[model samples]
Target: MSGLAASERSVRPSSGLSRFAAMFGKELLELVRSLKLIWVPIVFIALGIMQPVTSYYMPVILEKAGNLPDGSVIEIPLPTGAQVMAETLAQFGSLGALVIVLVFMGTVSSERNSGAVSMILVKPVSPASYLVSKWGAMLLLSSLSLLAGYGAAWYYTGFLIEAVAFKAVLSSFLLYELWLLVLLTLTLLLSTALRSAAGAAFAALGAGAVLSLLSNLFPKYAGWLPGALPGFARQAVMGSLEWSSRFGACLVATVMLLAALVLLANILLRRAAAID
Candidate 1:
């Protein structure tokens, strides 16, 4: 009895929470090692600064692009800070989103292709813990990148143009972050399901594009989709977003879809592991 108790004590398992934290730390360490934690945020900051600077100097640039016909006045009005900020968000939606999806698209697929995922699953970690660790780490990186970029954009916009309201910018940031979470989670889900990183990235980006196209084509009918999040975010920056049933539904739908993607990714990874 004494021997059995000692053996059991010696081999005692780690709590789920401990395993989760360990796994999350491992993911973060991987990000650091890969320099993703550094360069991605830098890219975002550069993107943020570009919008205000480019908008501020557009008239000057055009003036120097060769003399226009005399009296052919290009009376380009300077954009307000909120408009410039909105353009920055649009830049994020396109270029920044592509960068983010591409960076993370390989996370699971590369691990699985190299048998690292199988090795990971062989340990005493639950699939949920493993998947969520990746998910949480990616989310953390996204938050840091977005905040750095948004802050840079806000500062530059205020200096170069009019100052955007604190409340409006904050609201836009929260909404846009939620939208980004939904986007990244979808890419992560595809990465878990597909073995080809490029294929996963392509599919996720295509799906996002389709959703955005549909929302633009049918704004009244499709405003509740996740694609509408950016428009709502733009409205937030412009102080035009309102709390209505439709907006509430869109918010709830995005959250539900996020939860569903995380759950589905966990299930897919488990099924794949079981097959292995």
Candidate 2:
């Protein structure tokens, strides 16, 4: 305790912002060291590009896939560029979401296990600073990765299929990005509250799956839930949906829900009796 107290006095930030900046920088550095900064975007690009390429070549693939009966014909309609983009995002919501959860599953738990959280807390760090720093780093990586992957898909969709409206693509990307953030936030919440990183990942995925299942069961009533975001993204791509009260309500409600989750995470960390 005496050594910790002495170390705490050795370096104190002038303000809360400085302390947060320090912690945020550390988190970013850790991400780079883990090589997550490189491979995550690459994987997303692979997943993003696969959708358009496969959709464009489905006829050729089908013909060569296997030997059909003597006079077999499989005439399938080629999807538009907008449809392909929506499909790519659906891929993201499934596989991309899983990659993200696994990538960040140990965000806080590892720190706790290594005793870093105890040493850091002995200093002038606030729970908000600590949690926000980790989240901000993860969010930054996610934004960049999503942009690279989605941009590649849009470019290829234009080359192979019809070109989607830039406005619609942009709108869809923003909505999907927020949805991914909500998933990451849920993972962060569990990572902070639980000791097992794998358990945190599974629980977060299960909760999101349940939410999506319920929203599918009750669209009109569940529009305000985060599960509505994926459908909203698809609507943005299809250009069928408009800026209506339902959309507005869902948007505002999602933002509020995101903030509430962060506040709850802060309380959880602050009240935590042990980091390991």
Candidate 3:
């Protein structure tokens, strides 16, 4: 009987993996059907390209807009490629983050409200699989969008601005991506816990804002928070951050918080399923 039980346990993990893959496929299909696969990347690319172009033409733009005293020359120094890339990331940190939050805010809550989760849960699927599947889909979308955007920015920065180091760009990109992932995880957790999609989005955004404010206000203490990631990412791009001393604590804390969010999401989803 013990051997049989052990065999059953082993089989469960395999079955769970299969279920997760199937669910992840379904989530991807849904995203495609909703036209996210097409437009999200386009938006990211657009945002990416705009930064370098805007930076390159800043003097002209300011001259045209400033309407200074007749013949007043506006000699704005052009930003370096790395600075342009960092500014592009700033755009993503704000508008891009909002787009992502709004897009995924309804990922699980809407399905649960529509009884789709109940239907799916009637099968042998585990709540962890369901939540993880949603997370996987979100991660895929976010990564693709970020890569497209950052790639565009990098190319333009090299062409229009000074060339940035590949290592700096890569490190900054990953660090910024990590920060975005933290926000996405928080949204997913809130979506699983709250019934209203708007509420989830609002709560996630509010939490992010508060964290960022606290990090800015108390940098000495809140340096380990995920909110400090963008600053660290910018510093990396500018070749100023000491990764070993500056990022270690924040990286560990951010990852731990993300894992905790995922676990909480799964548990909340499981309880919701049980209640239904």
Using TM-score as the measure, which candidate wins? 1
Report the C-alpha lDDT of model 1 over 159-213, residue by residue, as the tens digit: 9898999999999999988888887888889999999999999888998888778
For candidate 3, write residues 137-252 as lDDT tens digits.
88988989999999999999999888899899889889988888988999999999999999999999999988788888898888778899998989999988885654788889
In the range 1-276, model 2's lDDT, one tens digit per residue, is 999999898764478888899999998998899888889999889998999999999988978986877678888899988999999999999999899889999888887878877778778888889999988987988988888899999999999998989999999999999988888999999998898999999998998887777777898898667888898899998898798887888889778877888899888887772533
- Report lDDT per candidate: 0.91, 0.88, 0.89
Reference-based TM-score, model 1: 0.95
List where candidate 2 sits over 4 angstroms from the true fold. Answer: 1-13, 273-276
Provide backbone clash counts, one per model.
Answer: 0, 0, 0
List residue ranges in candidate 1 displaced over 4 A. Answer: 1-10, 66-72
Residue 9 in candidate 2 has what lDDT? Answer: 89
CA RMSD per model (angstroms): 2.0, 3.4, 4.6
User: Between the candidate structures 1 and 3, which one is better when assessed by lDDT?
Assistant: 1
Candidate 1: pairs in clash? none
Whose lDDT is greatest here? 1
Q: Give the lDDT of residue 110 in candidate 2.
A: 80
lDDT of 3 at 141: 89
Clashing pairs in 3: none
